[model samples]
Target chain A: MYGMISTWRMAYEGVVNQFERLKEGEFAGNVLEASIREIEDFENFISVGYGGLPNEEGKLQLDAAYMNGSTFEIGAVAGMEDIKNPISVARLLSQDRFNIFRVGDGAKKFAESEGFLSENLLTDYSKNKWEERLKKVENEELTPYDGHDTVGTVVLDKDKNIVSGTSSSGLFMKKKGRIGDSPLPGSGFYADSDIGGATATGLGEDLMKGILSYEVVRRMGMGLSPMDAAQTSLKDFEEKLERKYGKVGAMSLVCMNNKGEWGIATNVDFTFVVATNEQEPTIYTSKRTEDGETVIEKAAAEWVEEYLSNVLTRQE
Target chain B: MYGMISTWRMAYEGVVNQFERLKEGEFAGNVLEASIREIEDFENFISVGYGGLPNEEGKLQLDAAYMNGSTFEIGAVAGMEDIKNPISVARLLSQDRFNIFRVGDGAKKFAESEGFLSENLLTDYSKNKWEERLKKVENEELTPYDGHDTVGTVVLDKDKNIVSGTSSSGLFMKKKGRIGDSPLPGSGFYADSDIGGATATGLGEDLMKGILSYEVVRRMGMGLSPMDAAQTSLKDFEEKLERKYGKVGAMSLVCMNNKGEWGIATNVDFTFVVATNEQEPTIYTSKRTEDGETVIEKAAAEWVEEYLSNVLTRQE
Candidate 1:
């Protein structure tokens, strides 16, 4: 009943893997930032988060928030810049009892806790080069549009518990002190295992006004499938904004209860990549071509197929 | 059982009121645009579908879409700017059967058919000064954070059937040709009265990825209260994004089912305003702040009090 590498399917892959791993306690209390960091694409994601769209002043500022539904706890930091790995701080908050404020402080604390020689190692030379570039570009001509670019994730356990979180450097380049939905809970990410979960990207304030995630989950509870739920939530939100505030942009999610059901809806045509159990993950792009709702399904379907195939062969 | 203005709520209000009015045959297809145009705070909500954010050249570019779940039909337009009311075109498509395209001449033809006079309103000196000033700025610099706006609605009739819709202009002063969640079905809005209905706002991409509305409806079918369902969806979506994206942002939602049981949930620290038949419409400017979750009881209680007071006075 479920095998489509559409946007929704890719998201389901991520969610299912997280849940499967969680069942084995492989991701205890630290699902917020344990991405496959060694992957180059993951690094690119960090760049998108940190050096992405700027704020009004073109200065780089950052904000992020995370929550683990398994524990019903969350942590966030706002208006920070020049710090690498905001997600790491969120991870620490999810794992450790102490609250870490600034990214610098969080890194120091984490290094000390992990017994690393220098906290700066987290920002190694290449990462520092990005930081240096951030400093130089702080004074660039800033525009209101630059304030964007963020990331987030959601995970559901086998027991049907769901958790979601997000991180972002506010906009592209920006005013010194600007805050978007990144640190905000529902606007950035909202999860309910019994129903589903959601995460957002793009314009924060616009989504916040509608309470995007909450709407998606509520609809799912009524019986819509995960994909339909996501689509409807966004449709309603956009309609209202057009009638009221006008300008807005963003992307995110709503995932169904843990039977590996989920959906991905986007305002703009974009691609969402995915990988599955022991598979070399690939990206899937969803856009409207000549035909309505043109979806490039199974671009990455082979990943899961190959992995499962290998397992079957080994058993044989 | 709710009060607080979120983009999601605004969207719900639009679709709910319009669909109801439309089903009652309040106006011919053309008049639906005027109806949506009359919503309170119309100017600010440029993101959904009306007078949206401008393109790189500083001219407003708009995108919008609509769907009828009952018929499984859809309509959309993209890259439309300087059009006063895009919803009118979308509603036209929803009401009538015709060839539809995502913007360009097709949408223009529809608008012209509906008597939409595009007379370069931006250059008119008598127009609102802020709008004129906004026109002076280049669109590339426009950001999505200009306003807390979004409008959508979903409604169910006595037959237990449902319909939902959304609209948005995208972020203010945005780059040329930037489209948000408004035009994408499911990402923008979703409704299935047989299952349930939901609307969303904030972070268009995020809502799309998670399929927020579909998830909520499914959960409702599982028998969770509307409020719980909404909260659970938000929680789960947020947790997922936090794991990959890091920083999170705000989003809000309003949902209802066949029984008219409505639920509201948000990750924002407040800013979600709600109004229902049982309660007077009220606004929430702050979250509980204790746990960062929305506190609707206070606002809901106040609404109840005001409603009850009015009822008793009338009886006396």
Candidate 2:
């Protein structure tokens, strides 16, 4: 999805609407949880949200991370299984430090203490344990793990402050022990309300090694347009991984100058949608491939108009 | 395969070798045709010189382009189906006008005038057309048309001269009336002995639209390594396609200075080997997936070495 930022008036309006039906404190929790849950539920083949391909081992092991650039607050988890919604946990952890939750057995214990069902399993593996198991199973028939591509958002408020969140299982069908860019601090998720906010999706290991976030931030600082900078970074990644070809794919969306502009670029052909208060959700893909010839400009115009309309309607 | 230069010595040696086996001036036509036939039989993946893939309509269409940078000579053809060996025809065309061989029905007449087999069908589509009524009645479906991917070669000889050639049937299962990058001057194959050379692989339409070959050449002029420039140009193709997370596999081999130093990059994890008189055939791929973790160094080393050894041994 394209970068999203609701103006102060837009967010305040949502808050006002929520206050009419619920208590003030409940609104923040509801909206955040709702947004995060949506991340968990995203199931499109193109988008990098939840329920995507498994790890190389073929099992669903979820991981996620998020950061509120405004407060310089962050949250993340590496190996969470039996958790239906990981983005929720990440959001909780990024909340007030007093309310920040720890993961692992303690996290499960806390969830149970709060009456959320927590499964009991003796064989759950931490990142370290998973690494050891990977060595042992190097020559064996290893099961694939879940590493769904990530879906994330960075919202710029009217004051131009920003909050960004990321959610993913990781690469689909990854190895049992593999950890992708998702849980890494700056690699998987980072945002700054002052200038702009960005989110990335693709091969996590490469992204982590490249320190991609810093590069994106650096480019943004140099005053390149969001689209040009994002596309340029993606091109760099392509050059680095040329010999591996299709083994990697990535997409990122960025909002700059308080949502005066935004950008989305990806390696493969797929759809990305953007929604804002002033526009209708607009969907964009390179060009729809039905029989083969690319319909280039037709698809672009449809997306731009639809997106603008969606944003306009949301203003009410 | 990365860029290669069959030295002027190698070409002369091959021609002389063929000449030695023939009686002086007795069958000069047969000798030259047989020599060209050698390259026609080199490889078979539907993308190589002869018998390439057909278009979606099951019609056989072929495109070929060749340039000898040393001589500043070039030849190209498109939508010709009856030519038995297009490369040979192209080579003849590039030589003195007296060497030009008539093709299609005219070629058959010329062959008969020269007492060679004049009735052999050059394309399956041509054979099918003769039996059109019977073909429609036949319940069995014929193999569907799959247009060829562009196959190209660039050679720098001992004289520091360059030669490049490309041939393709077009895209696999493509729409009718589609032409590929093979016949394009810069998109498919290009070489300049003073600078460098490159050949492209993947969907020709995407490459042409992106002006990939020109981009690579321009980047090389800016001091980027030949391999890096090729990869950067390919990345431009990917972004143009909006492939956020899919493979658009391609490979390009490039050489810089005449020190024979070269670089190769591909989107797939396949070994590309090359042989040199100074070094054994070397094989290389940038990354390999092993037990879930991708190993970059080992993949590159082994592939380069193996391929180089093979190519060198074959040359010997």
Candidate 3:
């Protein structure tokens, strides 16, 4: 089943709205790139692309990754700045005959040579957000949350091929030169003909601690449903972290099999968007049972509205 | 069933020699720490510790990671310099009560506060290595080999716990702030009480593209022997890369199940060491048959002699 999904609803909406382009026979890669372009341009999400938060040094160092599943080719950049759409730059790097990966200034130079326009990604809103935190920090500051959230989209194309892309400004006030799972190939997302596709959002430090996405995908390969794979991996992730920090550790994942079956899993109750050929885009909220099982429920719009602005902000 | 293994013979020898200390009932953590202390001080293995390779700027930047299997805790540092024993520093970060991760100056500051001594890790040999690469640049340097080889050791202790540590200088002449699988918990290594333990070497870029170590460990959980897990991962790694580059990519792995059954796999032909209670220290060579299957052979002393200085020097 051909479909697309993202960590944020707006991001998924931006892509699914472009589903008309697929009807017009546009390339899958172009749709994937255009999707993140929407998130990069969206002002509401403060965790990815332009207007996203900055590092401790007050610089918006971005990391972006894109993978072409049929070809098993990948492109990524870490600490790249100035480019408006890093996912496209990542695509350029992967498609270019000369290189598959570049970093920092070299990546920027490569993007420029490939005709990507350079611009400062920081916007007034993000600047204010960072400034507010700094002001909140008195002579002594409280430990802030790992506020890094990424824009990840996994699409299973008409041919059942999966392509995925991820972009992030990374942890709020994360260390300078810090590169998270966003730009890493397997840690952030993965897909194959043998398995399906999977992507993650949350504490990358925690997600990167285990197979995360691939664990779910390979479990799918082992005949577990996408939801079961995701739940199993999350169970392990929780057990791994709960020992030290009680119930702390943030991560949520979505999985899609080539058969067009998709399942969702998350440690906390949160909603993600789903788009497919037979249905309008809908939201699913994943909740954990008291017995430590994952449950997926269709989220009411009113509940989603409250969850996004209120519940998510508290998490940040 | 409790044991430790490393890439370098000298490193493994250091830990196995401490069998007496185990008999005297020393903590496994202390024994694991002491094992890596030898590698940290060894002058050979230019990819690790002091005198290792430098970044493009001619400054030595190091990456190290440590994991406690029993607690499922992980600590890592990337691009840290002026530290002789980054593996131990990683251990300190994991053991600390207040912090789980710190990077760049914050990590350096924390290390200093934790009483870690700072000194230039670059050695004359490493300095010359960087200079030579720059001088050898012709018109423009070609895409160099992956060139990243790390020091990873997995220890299974008396209580059947696993603790692993990886330390590296990353790729020869890599980007100034580039971080690789060495510091990533899953991409480079992963362990679970049910799944067993695994670690990797060579070309982190390739290994991180898949859930290399975790894939191996998960296969072990599925009833595959440690050797089968390693072989399956390496095969998939080769198939994935071969499709794109036609016989390009580099990686090696070691896997040890909770049962103390262990195996080694690599894309390139090389030998690694192993030692346990029932066996003397043995060097095993991984040779591929004409059908491209990996088979282990007892490496002769004479063949090992030429392979090390000849093959390893060429790889460097």
Model 2: residues with Cα > 4 Å off, grouped in runs: A1-33, A39-58, A96-116, A119-147, A241-257, A287-316, B1-316
For candidate 1, lDDT tens digit of each residue in B82-107? Answer: 56666666666554322332343335
DockQ of model 3, rounded to 2 decimals: 0.26
Please identify model 1 stretches exceeding 4 Å from their true place.
A1-316, B1-35, B40-52, B95-101, B104-106, B113-115, B121-144, B269-290, B297-316
**Better by TM-score, candidate 2 or 1:** 1
Tens-digit lDDT track of model 2 for A1-316:
1125221111222323332222222322344335555545533321123334443343445566566655545555444555656666666655532223122333333344545554422122323334544665575655333223466555554444555556565654453323455544445555655456666665564454233553454467568777666667666755544432233434443334345466555554444444444544344454324653333222367655664455444320
True lDDT of residue A145, candidate 1: 44
Query: Lowest summed lDDT over 10 consecutive residues: which window, candidate 2 chain B?
Result: B1-10
Cα lDDT for residue A29, model 1? 34
Can you list each candidate's DockQ?
Answer: 0.02, 0.01, 0.26
* Fraction of true A-B contacts recovered by candidate 2: 0.00
TM-scores, all models, native as reference: 0.45, 0.37, 0.86
Q: Each candidate: how many clashes?
A: 209, 71, 1
Tens digits of per-residue lDDT for model 1, A1-316: 1111212222334444443455464542343354411111233233234323333334344556566554435555454444455555555554532232222223334434554333122223224444544665655533234334455565554444566666665554332343455554456666555555666666654555455666666678778887888877787667655653444455555354445566777765555543323333345556544533536454456655654465334321
Candidate 3's docking class is: acceptable
Give the TM-score of chain A in candidate 3: 0.90
Predictions in order: lDDT? 0.50, 0.45, 0.72
Ranking by DockQ: 3, 1, 2
